[model samples]
Target chain A: MSRKLSYREAMREAMHEALANDPRVFLMGEDVGRYGGTYAFSKGFLDEFGPERIRDTPLSELGFVGAAIGAALGGMRPIVEVMTVNFSLLALDQIVNTAAALRHMSGGQFSVPLVIRMATGAGRQLAAQHSHSLEGWYAHIPGIKVLAPATIEDARGMLAPALADPDPVVIFEHAGLFNIEGDLPDDWSADIRSARVRRQGKDVAIITHGGSLPKALAAAQTLAEQGIEAEVLDLRVLRPLDSESIAAAVAKCRRVVVVDEGWRSGSLAAEVMARIMESAFYELDAPVVRVCSEEVPIPYAKHLEDAALPQPEKIVAAVKEMMG
Target chain B: MTDHHAAAPPSGPVPWDKAFALRLLTDMLRIRRMEEKSAELYGAGKIRGFLHLYIGEEATAVGALHALAPDDNIVATYREHGHALVRGMEMGSIMAEMYGKHEGCARGHGGSMHLFDARTRLYGGNAIVGGGLPLAVGLALASKMQHEQRITACFFGDGAVAEGAFHESLNLAALWKLPVLFCCENNLYGMGTALERSESQTDLCAKAASYNMPALRADGMDIVAVHEASKQALRTLRESAGPVFVEYQTYRFRAHSMFDAELYRQKAEIEEWKTRGPIHTFTARLKAEGKLTEEEFLAIDAAANEEVAAAVAFAEAGTWEPVDDLLKDVMTPPPPAPRPGGGDAGSPPAAAPCEG
Candidate 1:
């Protein structure tokens, strides 16, 4: 029995459930214990799970993240939350070299089974250092699963399967979706391998994930007002991207517009476009156009931040462009 | 402190017998010969890419590895030809890996710096400084959690001590009382930078002690001393108290890599260290004790040369992986399910009972 909850509440519930159910599962990150997480995601978890499980780590991304990987390899289910994707750069070596490569490098003898969660995307006037979506970079690596839990159901469900997976899984929780509320049905079980179609349509397919999903859906609404029905596909699993579902959507819609919060050059949207070209090129009515963040560091000012990110209006424009 | 050189030798010639000593010497010599050949191969452009040789540090790996059981896991740095050789990985496969051939232990994916053998429980040839330390800690953690009687021996250079992974691994190992042997080869130089210039506290043992773990130092050039220290450390670690740190004061007889100009240290310095090389010093000690003669030493050298020659031939005959199957081993292939009636059923009958 699930109720409508915000993305932040959904994630907090997932952590709370994991801690309550699994004795070995623990949460460690900056401000996750006492300060209730940087975005107030784990507000009262310290009191509930105690300091041991809901740990507050020092501002050592490389140190703590590497320790989390070690702890995972040590037979503990550790969920390490890096405050932002920008800060995750400090721990990239551990993530890419150790967690992602260990299973394959060890000749399938070991698996890390770690879950690294971080808030990505830029739109809150957080400036350059605090903002940036690098999920595309993580998605490029093999032997690791990449997930973008954009919906409330996914925010609630992704953690369990991620913990169950043998290999390492990196979950990108966009900062913008934290406060957005959505319905969580009673039988909401999220699959880590398929893309969920948030809205059904026939004119065009709006392929997006993470923070861009809401914008894509909103743009679809705007597109519906203009008599062009757009289907919104939220790519939950980003790494072994559900290409079959994407191909099916492309084959049905005949036109596609990808909206991603990452930069335009070499983004996950580019990978999706390439997949469409490889699998469903003949079914396309027009060339796939992408509405990605401008190739620049996210700005601090509200207007520039909005301009630098993929906004609903921009996604609508891209859909209209694809339609013509 | 009284000099222990004249002290009574342990009852009946210590723990190592003649066969074990000979095997240790053979292992060191094998690494020495293989590395020498690899250097020659590098010069001739047969083996490309970065090659960090473990020439003078052979005793540190050979002696320390001999102290560990076959079930124990080993994680080593990029300069791990010695570790891989002593860890019981096939010499031909390791050489083939360095040659980037499909017959390599890692199937040609990881070359000189990344040789891995799962059968021997050798974790990696990790190139990142202090990278293997945490992995060793984790392996030990797994053993501790699973109640397995195994210790993980991690080898890294003095340069890796400066990395955060080193500190974090030490703290975690101590905090958890994990059975990990942190073997730091204090070669005194990190690529071009020396230990004195890089570290504020040059005493590596003191740093390990700060984490509340047992720490010791040994003359890495002396193979017997390295063996005794490592054996004691491994014994303590296997008992599951906590991690132990052994700082082997060693030196590199050659350039850091083939491309290194070696402007960081002096030529005469290398010549001075070469005087106390592990191979010669240990051979001299064995001869003095009547355990080895000049002819026996020549035989060991000849055996190492033959082994290396055979490895080179194997690598030369090794093939390259086909480009079409580049994506293999990225993930483990799902195992084939068992048939319903216990017979081999191709692709499993559609209505058959699901057997994992």
Candidate 2:
């Protein structure tokens, strides 16, 4: 049996289940408790779980995030919520220098079993400070796992396994997809390792993840109408990218268009393109193209923001150009 | 501040019993001997990278470590040879680590700046100025939540006082009332920058007190003072299950690192501070109190020198970790292969390098 659920509801249900199942699991971040989460994901959680579990922290990103790492070291599973990717920069030292490096530095004596979830990507005219996808920057690190849950099933199911993993895992929840609805099957489960084929086709592979997944799917629909079949691949895991799945898609389609919400230069799209060149260069039917955000701070103006982001029309245009 | 002299020569009677007092003196002697040999090895090119010696700060580490239980957590700075030694990390492992050998504490991965020992619950030799504070706070948070009778003692230099991490970590620990003992080793200088030059408020305990935690100060060059202050702080932390901060007023007797030119401070100031060297002053006091004799002091010094020589031999015999295992321990290894019959299915492949 399957039921319709929004991404926000599914994620909420997932967190509720995690908290209920494990006494060691607790959520701590700015506005996570009494304020019901900055995005309202934890609405009414404080009432049910009380102050001890659903902790509301001050705007001390470096302090709280580092503390979460310490707690994880002290034998507790901790999930930290950074309100947005932009603010996570304040805590980057803990994430990169400490959490990521601890296991290797300690000669395999310690592993930080921590999950950090943050809102990423641009869409709601939140302006420069609130928008911008830096998941790629995090993906560039060596010791952590990066996940972008694009669908309801993933938003609901990724948290459990992420908590189960022994190393630090970072999940990017696209701010734009919270209200989007989809039918989540009762057996929905997710693995935090590989890319998933959202829509399979043969003409072109539209490779993307996070907020760009829906845009690539929409472009695939438009391409289907034009008698061209496009394969949509969601790069669910970014750090340890699923090169096998990416190569499989490229081998099948022979042409690729990478859609990323981050800027074009040194972007996730660039990484995906590099991987295609490295792994499946012989399978290329055409030069791999990318549809990424314009190289500018995401602005508040709606039209300008739309122009800067990777939209359905942009993905469609890139794929069409490749097909031609 | 430069205005302050060598702290009136740490005047006090030796209060501990003869055996306990001698043990403290012996630990201090061990650190001094080991680090002096480390300096020679660095000059000889056996120990490479930045070697930050904890020469003058021995009293702080020896005193504070003896005050805490073996199970309590310790997070320390890059100049952590003394802390690791007092915390029970073998002297040979510390020397081997500095040699970048696999037998070292961190398997040659973490050199002088990142010594970590799980057996002693010593979290790290965190190189960043204020990096270890948050980890200490977090460990304290875990202890409190799990109702464990353990506290986390985090040590950083006076330079870390200027870092935002210092302010933020203190606030978080105090706000949650976590069992953390923030040990600020005020060695008067952070790298080359003097404390007054770096901070507007020169009093470190004032800053910690501003975060609503009780803060204390001790004569860092005097092991008895540091040990007594630490004991008092730990007692309060355990009783209240809250954070406490202690400022150990001390000085570094050597250059910040092997590469340091030390152009910032004057020769007279270093010489003046050396008069109150923790080892000699404590030995003199013990002699005056009839707890230690000249023969006993010479014997202890000789023993420490012997241990350092043996440690160097151990380091010279240590092997290098192969480049083939470079990526090992970067992430946890995958779970043991699934049961034979049923066969584990749907397990994500272990994270391997993209280049491979």
| Best-performing candidate as measured by DockQ | 2
For residues B1-356, what per-residue lDDT tens digits would candidate 1 score against the true structure?
A: 11112212122342467778888889999999999999999988889899999999898998888888898878888898889888888899999988988888877777898888767877788888988887787667656656878888889999999998899788878876888899999999999999999999998988998888888778888788789888777766656478988888899998899999998898999999999899887777777777888888899999999999999999999999887757766754544443332112121112211111
Model 1, A236-296: lDDT tens digits are 9999999998998999899999999889999999999999999899999999999999888
Error of 1 at B10 (Å): 13
Query: For candidate 2, lDDT tens digit of each residue in A208-254?
Result: 99999998999999999999999999999998999999999999999
Question: How close is chain B to the truth by TM-score, in each candidate?
Answer: 0.90, 0.92
Clashing pairs in 2: none
Q: Candidate 1 lDDT (Cα, whole model)?
A: 0.83
Per-residue alpha-carbon lDDT of candidate 2 for residues B1-356, written as tens digits (9 for 90 to 100): 11122223235677689999999999999999999999999999999989999999899999999999999999999999999999999999999999999999999999999999888999999998899999998988888888998889999999998888998999999899898999999999989999899888998887887888888888999999889888888887777668888889999999999999999999999999999999998998889889999999999999999999999999999999999999999998776543332112232233321111
lDDT, model 1, position B97: 89
What residue runs in model 1 are displaced by over 4 Å at the alpha carbon? A12-28, A31-56, A71-77, A103-110, A277-282, A321-324, B1-17, B43-46, B147-149, B175-177, B210-213, B232-240, B334-356
Minimal lDDT window, size 10, model 2 chain B: B347-356
**Candidate 2 — which residues are off by over 4 angstroms?**
B1-12, B336-356
